[model samples]
Target: MSSKELTDKLVAAIKSGKYDAIICNYPNGDMVGHTGVYEAAVKACEAVDECIGRVVEAIKEVDGQLLITADHGNAEMMIDPETGGVHTAHTSLPVPLIYVGNKAISLKEGGKLSDLAPTMLALSDLDIPADMSGQVLYS
Candidate 1:
């Protein structure tokens, strides 16, 4: 589905007030970036940006939190420095991990993906399992 459609569903779900946590992935950035079209990539980012605004509003309505993150920054660079063509592969760049909520959360800097689960559990007021591979992202 398009990012707009996906975000619409996400907003609806958030408004339902039936969930303690929600995870969303907008494939537009990575999937469309693979096409190696700069204009398409820009449009993809814009689409995701718009969707994110809607999501933030939904989260506000429900008094929930948002954690926006990604595994790779595929759309960050679209030009190949050597070949003069579009960069179509994922990069080694650090991905973003943004948190939004009313809670005064103090997130640790330089957190890795493994920190996500523990952070989520801590945010939910649940104990981080002893077997969890990472430490909670609170400083």
Candidate 2:
């Protein structure tokens, strides 16, 4: 399904108050970025941005915490300035780690992608395993 559809369902789920946790991944940026078409990537970002506001509102209604982060960077450097060619692969650049909520969650610095797991667990009020390598991003 498209990002809109997925987001709509998520909003409904959030409003329903049926679950303690909800997780969503919009594949538009990553999937479209893989095509190495800058124009398409722009549209993809616009679409994701449009959907995010609705999500933020729903999260506020439920007084829930939201952690928004991408697995990797793509479409940001679609055109390789050095090679003057289309870059179709993921970039090594750091991805954004955004937290949205009424209650503050202090984001820890030096957090890696692995930190997402621990962060989610913390948000859900679940215990973190001792062997887990990822650090909790919020305290």
Candidate 3:
């Protein structure tokens, strides 16, 4: 879908007031970056930024929480040159985790992906199951 359409739908959902939180992955940075199109990647990042801004606005209207993160990093920082039409394997570089909400959580530098689930659960006032390996980031 076009950016405008996507934005409209997101705004509509936010206004619906059915959910308490918003979890979104603006895939442009990851997808466009994989093709080695630097310009397109930049544009995609801009688009994602705009989408994020809109989402944040919606969240603000309801005094709700917004969790913005990525499962992995494929854009912004390219560690190596693309070769012969083949993109490089995923980097060991850490992904970003940003939380904007009422709950308090402190994320230390070099945190691992495993820490996310527990942190989120804690934020929602939910218990982290004993079987989970991650600790609550703040608690």
Best-fitting candidate, scored by lDDT: 2
C-alpha lDDT values of all predictions:
0.87, 0.88, 0.71
Q: Model 1 residue 49 lDDT?
A: 93
The estimated TM-scores of all candidates read 0.93, 0.92, 0.81
Candidate 3 local distance difference test against the native: 0.71
Backbone clash pairs for candidate 3 read none
Stretch of 10 with least lDDT, candidate 1: 104-113
Could you give candidate 2's per-residue lDDT for residues 2-111 as a string of tens digits?
A: 98999999999999989988878998888998999999999999999999999999998988888888888897889988999998898889887889987566777767
Q: Which residue runs does candidate 1 get wrong by more than 4 Å?
A: none
Query: Residue pairs in steric clash, candidate 1?
Result: none
Model 3 reaches what TM-score against the true structure?
0.81
In the range 1-52, model 1's lDDT, one tens digit per residue, is 8888898899999999888788888988899788889999999999899999
Which pairs of residues collide in model 2?
A: none
lDDT of 2: 0.88
Whole-structure CA lDDT of model 1: 0.87
